[model samples]
Structure formats: C-alpha cells, structure tokens
Target: MRLASTIRGVTYSFRSIKEVLAKANSHKSGDVLAGVAARDAVERVAARAVLADVTLEELRNNPVLPYETDEITRLVEDDLHEPSYAAIKHLTVGQFREWLLETSTTGELMRSISRGLTPEMAAATCKLMSNMDLMTVGAKAQVVVRANNTLGLPGRMSSRIQPNHPTDDVQGILISAREGLSYGCGDAVIGVNPATDTAESTRDILMALDEVTRKNRIPTQNCVLSHVTVQMAALDLGAPMGLMFQSLSGTQTGNEAFGISVSLMDEAWAKMKEMTPTKGPNVMYFETGQGSELSSDAHHGADQVTLEARCYGFARRYDPFLVNTVVGFIGPEYLEDGAQITRAALEDHFMGKLLGIPMGCDACFTYHARMGQDELECLKVLLGSAGVAFLMSLPVGDDIMLNYQSTSFHDIPSVRGLLGKRPTPEFDAWLSEMGIWDGGKPGPRFGDQTVIR
Candidate 1:
C-alpha cells in the first residue's frame, strides 16, 4: 500500500500500517515510549494525511496481524456482515469520517453500517478526527445492553457502583453501594474489584452484592471484577453472579499474558450462562485500556488505538453488557497527563460505539500523573456530553482498592443535572420511589444511604 505523503513540500514515508497508525495518532506517551510515535508534530500531521487517503478495503485486507495468524483478527474479519462491509469498504478514511459526521447520517444508519466496519477501519477513521469529531460521531451511535437492567439508552447515563474495599469487606462494599444508590447511581451494576482473587473471596463478595441487591429490591446487577478463572471457580462454588467480568486484550499474545485465551473465555461464557443467576443475552462485562498489549509485549508493533479497537472486536464476540477503558490508570507513562487521557477516552468511546458495543470510561488518574481530580472531573464532563453509556462511581471518586481517582457517587447526579440526563428507566423509577430523585434531579433523600430501608 502507498504509505507516504507530502505536506508543505516535505515528504513523510511510513514502512508499514503499524507505523502509519502509530504516527498518525494524537500524541500519547505509550506510542512515544514504544518508539513508534511521529518524531515531531509536522510528521504526525503528515501521517494523518497519508492515513486519510487509505481505503477501508485496504485496512480490512491488511490487519496489523494477519487474519490467519491472529484469532482476534480472524474474529474481527469473520464476523463482518458482508453486505454491510460492501456499503462502506470503498470509502477512504477521510470520506468515512465525513460520512459519519454528515447531517443525514443518523444513529440507525451508523448502526447499520457498523456491522461491516472492521476495528482497523474504525481506528483509521478515528485518526482523522479531532476531539469534537470523536464526540459528535460517538453521539450518533446507539448501543443498548441488558443483564438485570438496561444501559446505553439515549438521554441516560449509568454508573457501576464500585464498592471496593482494601480488605474485601462485604459490609463496607454494601455501604458504598447504598451511598451510590442514594444518589441515583448503580443502575448499570454494582461491581467490585476484589483485593484477593481467591474463589472463596470472590464468592462471598458476589453473594453479598446479590443479597443486598435483592434485599433492597434494587433494580440493578452485581459483579466482582476478578480473573475469568477465579470468577469461574466462584461460579463453581455457586456464587450468584449478576455479570461475569474479565479484562480483554486485542492480540492472542496479550490474552496469554492475561492468562486467558479465546477458548478459555468461551468456556467461561458457557459457564456464566449455565451458573450465573443474571438474565441472559448479554451476560458479561469487559474492561480494556490502551497500552495493555504493549505492556504485555504483544502489540505486534501497532499503535494503542488500533489494538484497543481490536479489543472491541474481541468483545463483540460475546456481546458484553458493559465495556469500558480504565483510562489513565496505567499511569503517566502511557497516557502522560490529562490531555492524553482525555484524547484516549474519547477515541475509545467513539470506536466502541462505531463497532456496535455499549461503551463507558473510568475517566481516572493515578496520583503520579501530572494531573489530578480537576482533570478527572473535566473528563467526566466531556464523556457525559459525548453520550457515554456509563461511568464508574466510587464512594467519593477514590477507589481505595484500585488506588485511583474515579467519578464519585455525587459526581453522577451532578453530571446528570448539568447535562439534563437521568439514570436508567428502571433505576430512575426506583430512585423516585425511594424519594431520592425527582424532576430529573436529586431530591430530599439524595445522599442518605439509609434509604435502602
């Protein structure tokens, strides 16, 4: 493929698709550290110029990993609805971006075309978009998923009550869930990242979340974020699961690093279906982030965004109920600071939606990053304005177990109020019934965890 461009009389040439994608990406510390990033701003713009002219057909035909070698690539290619791909495969990346942003391109139309688009095509189109472009295009797509409740409905923003404790305390977890519920959060699900991944610890936590969910008649789901194997073991011990959880990667090598494979996950899917008490069709939740594959030495020379899109392709195999990037949690080395995190979060949400999946973000930052809570709040606002499906909520935006700052229980209603959004229909009804939400805003009993009574 032609991988060179001339801008301002300077010609920039790239040797491969990997280089093209890496250089074309907006600045990110991960790509730079990988030594794949553009050497300078001028070259970066030049790469975008070259990438913009590449056709979707070229991208589909030339995955970063050959389809025959990479199961993730095979899954991405094999699942394409041929008719849908044919409709847009002829368009250049620049043309595709324009089509997506066209006033006539409704959400329904995007969904129809989405089935044909490959992750490479999505990432390629993303490279040509600005921050606002990503938001506007992302807002034009709709993807809804349901387990115990629904998510991704328009005019709705949901939260996963991350009641994580340092000691795996069930009561502490329940207390956090109750506080989140008081502020009209937890419509998406109440999920926990256990400090320990033992089958017993996971089982107890899952059963506790399930108990509180039922006892309070909360219209939500519950899950413990553990390794698929650990969760599988817990399911074997009869842990009542709401949504089985796992972290995903784009390449098989990366999956291996995570101690999972396609077959292993397929087995887990079947097990969750057979054992978990949660309702079906969408029975899994997945978390993915940029730099994971590189960190695992499995990036195959690709940029983070391309690999990340492949994650959505991989996730598409199971039709997960929820998928989000733990943005900025990887620290400043990969994302650098608030600007890079903001860019990655928007790109991830946009790509996931374009590929037809429910997408959310953990819009968080590590303490060592050159950013802080103010930057995190800025990201939360941007995601809310971009029509994100959900965001993670902690006691006060501090995940003690995970050691990162995320959205707080109060941030949920604050964003909802600012954007004139509400929780899921089921949870909104429950919130109103409990006197904690009214007229699209917090009511008399808003921050009272005692409302669980």
Candidate 2:
C-alpha cells in the first residue's frame, strides 16, 4: 500500500524517498514553534515578572544567573521602573509595527528595549505577530540597521573566496584563489578548508596562502578552516591570527563534539588581539547551518531555524568578523527542495540580521538533495537584496572538494553590478588596479576570464 494520507478531502502520497524526507523536514517550522514554547515556558514566570514590572533591576544586575522568582518579585515591587516597558506600554501590535518601520536606527530601538525586555521577552511578544508582520519587522530591521550601523562587517559589499582544497594541494588552492580574485571577488577574505585536519597541515596551508597573497599583492586576509584546536595550534606555530576560523552550534554538546568551547574561543579572541592587521580587526570567520543540531543529535525538539538562530547568539558572543549560514547545505533531510531551501535561506538571513548579526548566505545545495543551481541563484539575489555581507566564491559555481554548487566567482560581479554595489573598498581598489573593475561597471576581463589564465 502507498504511504499516503488524506487531509481536507485531498490525498497526498510520498512517491519517493526524497518526497518522504521533504514531508518529514516540513515539520521543522512547527518544531521551531514548539521549541520556542518549551523554552519560553521555563522563563514564563520571569517574562511575566518583567511584564508586571516586578524584577527588572535584579534581572539586569545579575545577568549571568538564572532568575529567582521571589527575590525578583520583591525587587520589581520595590518601585523600580524601566523606561523601555513604558515606551511600549500603550502600543498595540499594529502600532508597534508602524513604529518599528518608521524607526531610523535599530541601535536606538535596541537600546530602548534593553532597558527592560530580554531578547526572549521580545521574541515571545513577536510570536503573537502574523507572518506578514514578522516579515515586515525583519525587512525593516535590516534596512534601518544596515543604513545606520555597520554591525561587524566591513562597510562595503564583500566576497569570500572559498578555495576549499580536499588534499590541500598548493597549486589547486592558488589557482582557485587567482580565479576568484581575477573576477573581482575576495574583497572580504580568501579562506580554505585543508584536505587534512592537523596543526601542521593547517599551518602549511596558511603559509602557502600567505605566500601567494603577498606575492600577488592581493589585499585580503587568509584562513585555514580546520578544527579550532588545529587552527589554534597553527596560531601557536606563528600563523597570523588575522583570519581565525570556527564552526559554532547552539548547544554546548554540539560544540564539544567539534572540540570547541567558550574558553577556547576566548583564547582565540585574545590571540587575535595580539596580532596587528593592515586593515580592519583580526576578525574570526564562523560557519553555521540549520539542521546541524538535528544532525548532531542536539536539537532538543526545537525548530531547526530557531536552533540556527541560537547558533548566531553563540557566535555573536565573540563579535565574529563573519557569520555565514550555509542555508541549503544540510540536504533533503532538513530542507527538501528549492522552495524550502529558498525560504530557509531568507529566514536565516532575516533572523540573523534582526538579532544584530552580520549575516551571509552560502546559497548552495547538494545533488543528493535534488536541488539545482537555479534555486541557489534565486536565493543569492534575494540575499543580496537583503544586504548580505558576503557570499562564497567557488570556481565556475562548483566546489570540487565539497561537491556542491554555489555562486561562482563570475556571479559576484554580476550580482553586485546589478544591485549597484562594489566589493569592499580596499579590494575594489585592487580590482581597479588589476583592470578588472572600470568605474562602477565590471571590466571586460570579468566576463571573459572565467578560468585561471
């Protein structure tokens, strides 16, 4: 018999394994809401205390600990008042939506809310909003915040040249970097995932990348994406901390599996501060994806997207230089097709930005997921509209090591050109000097030179 069900007088069938996975993955949105409810329940009494103006000061003072109800209640009733609560006291959801839309800067809005409401409280109230209202808030937040603040990203359109090497082949890495830079990408950074995961391998790759970058006078930082411990060892071996790298997850357990801990991150940050960069801070690069919690068995029944946001919260603790959500990389088990992939990518970008994280989207998918380049392209343009900080640069839209299709080096100039954007200022100058960028338009070489010469 067919595995089928009837709903609202319509019957649906899971025709293939992919369809089954799609149906299973479609429950993630509901799971997210359920997870939120479960999490909010634990803080329900605290949330109410804040709403009742019962314990605002105590909560603010002891931000490090879990809330104690009786003490907080007594403190709240002791005549302490929060101005942020007062600001939103008489406003309805519709009114708040209008206010948020009209607000010129997120910093001001965030500051006002910080006086009283915790992010959980704000998110709880947001749950009452309709999807359209939530979408409006996300869109408005990005516009106002981006227009008014740089967040943590560089102040121009940037691209990351991800010359990921499976075998850490020096020639392959150099060729890939050369190709991406020739097409006016790599303004933000040129990073690689070494074929082997070890301190020596990572150091060797970083050294090789450094040699090529200096030899060609390319204006970009370099990274070797191995385990954090390996990279830390590389730093101990005298690799510059200009481009520290890590992949973070929402839960503590998830991080432990990757041999990452908050203390380790702190050590890396401290190490970064010890190094000097020619431009910008020695920023760290972080990659996170939805379904990671589930894949790692750390999901805790929450929506994957919600868990993904928690990952951002964790990453933000470090003030990361770059936070990229590889939106569709998890495959059909979590996000089945192009439509789900596109929606998830937008949601991640919107949520990340709303949470005040400088976000980027690796709009990519795997062949096993039954998705294609066209869908990724759609997500890329949508993210560009949302003012994503940067995107991955593969050679000709294909990553041989990762075995995935993403926006290629050529796609960068085309997307930026269409949106009236340019690479980060320093990289733009380098591109101009190299004759790949002419004024605001791309030079002829940009279109003609797809392969490394």
lDDT of 1 by residue, 1-453 (tens): 789998888889899877898899999999988888899999999999899989999888889998778889888888899999999988999999999999999999999988898999999999999999999989879898888777888999998889899999888888888888888889888999989889999999988778778887888888999899999998889899889899999999999999998889899999888887777679999999999999989998899999999999999889899999998888888899889999999999999999999999999988898887787888899999999999998888888888888899889989998998888888888888889998776789888889885
Off by over 4 Å in 2: 1-99, 103-155, 276-279, 444-453
Q: Candidate 2 versus the native: TM-score?
A: 0.74
Alpha-carbon TM-score of each model against the true structure = 0.98, 0.74
Per-residue lDDT for 262-302 in model 2, tens only?
77888877776666242444367789887786777765444
Give the poorly placed runs of model 1, Cα more than 4 Å off.
none
lDDT of every predicted structure (CA atoms): 0.90, 0.61
- The backbone clash count of each candidate, in order, is 0, 3
- Cα lDDT of candidate 2 equals 0.61
Question: Where's the lowest-lDDT run of ten residues in candidate 2?
Answer: 143-152
For residue 57, give model 2's deviation from the true position in Å: 13
